[model samples]
Target: MTIETDRLRDLVAAELGRARDRTTLLTESVDEGDLIRQHSPLMSPLVWDLAHVGNQEELWLVRDVGGREPVRRDIDELYDAFKHPRRDRPQLPLLGPGEARRYVATVRDKALDVLSRSRLDGTPLVDQGFAFGMIVQHEQQHDETMLATHQLRTGAPVLEAPPPPAPAVPVTGEALIPAGPFTMGTSTEPWALDNERPAHQVIVPAFHIDRALVTNGQYAAFIDDGGYDDPRWWSEAGWAHRQSAGLVAPQHWSRDGDGWASTSFGRTQRIVADEPVVHVCFHEAAAYAAWAGKRLPTEAEWEKAARLDPATGRSRRFPWGDDPPAAEHANLGQRHLRPAPAGAYPMGVSPWGVHQLIGDVWEWTSTDFHGYPGFAPFPYREYSEVFFGPEYKVLRGGSFGTDRSACRGTFRNWDYPIRRQIFSGFRCARDA
Candidate 1:
């Protein structure tokens, strides 16, 4: 094989291993009981995620790419995400924690073997090692999900990470993005998912966005101002859902005497005013924006702030540059359980001076989820196509729990507007 092919194989192997390591850490940190138990109706049992990642690896890499026999054909239906919802996953005959670990390990061994021998330049799935990249990203996505499960589990904190560093430079106020058209999607991001395809141009009016994310202290003021009780600050649907859900503060937060505290990963601590507020649904973000006389940015505006460099008139792969994410760039890959202070990653700021745009929180956007113009689904429709519509809202920027493998400037994540269990937050935008 050529040197380039050898390098591709090694890179693919490393990423696959990286993703699996995180999966192992998330599952093995707790006992078998925690592995099988569903912490909430919103997420699957940890073991289900474990074995499901393996099943996907086997189907895509070992069987489809390598043309090998099925590893466990009968169990495919058991791990099918659409067939079995999170609420019902606990009752499924899932592989035990140990069994799931062994299954994934075995699959990884064979998948690597296939990668060592397979050509990386043929077929759409294998081209540029997209299938391998997809599998790596798939596992990392589940790792993030498993990390969320860890956060939801009731017990002493079984997982730990030192706090993210304090802000390097003082970041306050807003940054202005001039009005113009910039590339909105990607045709060049080799591993980009189908939704962020067919690079498109979006013309955005001039706007100013928060230099940093809204912090806990800022959100606290909203709550104190009766942001929830007032319907005028919320949309009709948002107000209805707010009343039904009995909305108070962000999830896991409670009034601590005259102050406020939050429970995270089974430990209760006082809320840090500087940390970007998380666990907030889209409705809460929108309400907070409305109260502040602003609005959640449309996805295009958010992208322009993150990717466009006015001097070069080129869109970058990340806020910092084309280089992959680094520890200093943003809080990612579960490195720290929570986000750093709002202006923490100065080195990671965009050319437009937007801080922490690539991580910290999945910033909510005002735009409803939809396919870009000239979009086409590749591999499968289930990944991005089926979910397209007004019912789901788009979220940009990966959060603290998001992995670099699955996140980019063009990456898109969507969920129900009312769902808050996932790591989410927002920065307000206003017309220039």
Candidate 2:
């Protein structure tokens, strides 16, 4: 193998090893049987998740690559996510702690050896990229599951840690962006999800997309104005959503008159008026937009406004010219696990003046979540396939808890209007 290939292989191997190490360390905090019992229904058992992740890697990277099937044929039948019977995973020989960890260690060693000598050049790297991607994702997911599992097992939230002192707010002014035919979606790059395919032209007439997400104080204004009680501020769907859930405000918002408080790291702290409102739902955002005489941007318009390149109409992994999100810029998971003041990342701005497009909070758009033309499922059968119609609307950008890689330009996410749990919220755009 070439030096570049060798180096890449080694790096990939190391990444997997790091996941192994993290999971190992996390296990020390709780008893294994108790962990499995607590989070069983919400998360797969540790042994099951571990074996399945590795078995999936081998199946996709080896057997599907026009290479020989695994020495154990049943491994695919046993561990493949597509193959595994959903919502019925507990009956299997889910691994115990020591055994499950050992299984992960063994399969990883085998995968490294196979990859080091495999001849998969010119073959689509989707299997290779997504396999490694999902494995890392799965392990990291396991870490979260274990934590939540511990809570489910223990009946209390585990991440009850407090945040450090707040950074003083910056005084800033409105940024004006003159809009035009801003082309939307990915115009460059080969690897992207099905929702981002058929990279086509979109015409966005001039409009004012907010320079930042709606802030705590701004949302408070809506609440103070009786936005919920007034019918003029809500669509039929939005009104029904509000009435069904008995939701009157953003999930973490609290006001005691003299001051405000917002939830952070699973605890409440003094509210910063300028902080963008995170942890809201599509329904809540729609109502707020209606009240403001603005509407959510179409997914096309949101993508166009958020796109960074002029020459290629390329998608960006982040806004502000694709330098991965930084602490000073956005309030992503790596940060306080909470909202950040909007406009925190000036250099991270898009081609237009849209801020917080990458992280901070996922912004809900008016567009319904649907697949592009000629879309097909890859490894996971029901990923983008299940929600490919108008039943759900599109959401752009990402939230504080979002996986950074999952927020790439052209990436699409959808949820029923009622799912306010994912830390999603929105900004509005006025028709020009």
lDDT tens readout by residue for model 2, 1-432: 577666656766776676666566546555656535535454555556656655665665555532654645555566655655535666765556676566566666677666666653455443344455555555654554443334334332334333322434343433333455544455343345556666666566666677678888888888888998887878787788788878888775677676567655345577778777866788788888888777777787677767646656555555666665666555554344456676566656776667777776778888887766556565565657877777887887766555454456677778777766556778888866
Clashes of each: 0, 1
lDDT of each: 0.93, 0.63
- Give per-residue CA lDDT, model 1, range 38-142, as digits (tens): 999999999999999999999999999999998898899999999998999999889998888888889988999899889998699999899999999999999
Candidate 2 has a TM-score of 0.79
Off by over 4 Å in 1: none
What are the per-model C-alpha RMSD values against the true structure? 0.8, 4.3
**Runs off by more than 4 Å, candidate 2:** 14-34, 37-55, 62-100, 126-131, 134-157, 160-183, 187-190, 252-265, 310-317, 322-329
TM agreement with the true structure for every prediction: 0.99, 0.79
Screening candidate 1 with a backbone cut-off below 3 angstroms (N, C-alpha, C), the clashing residue pairs are none
Residue 285 of model 1, lDDT score: 99
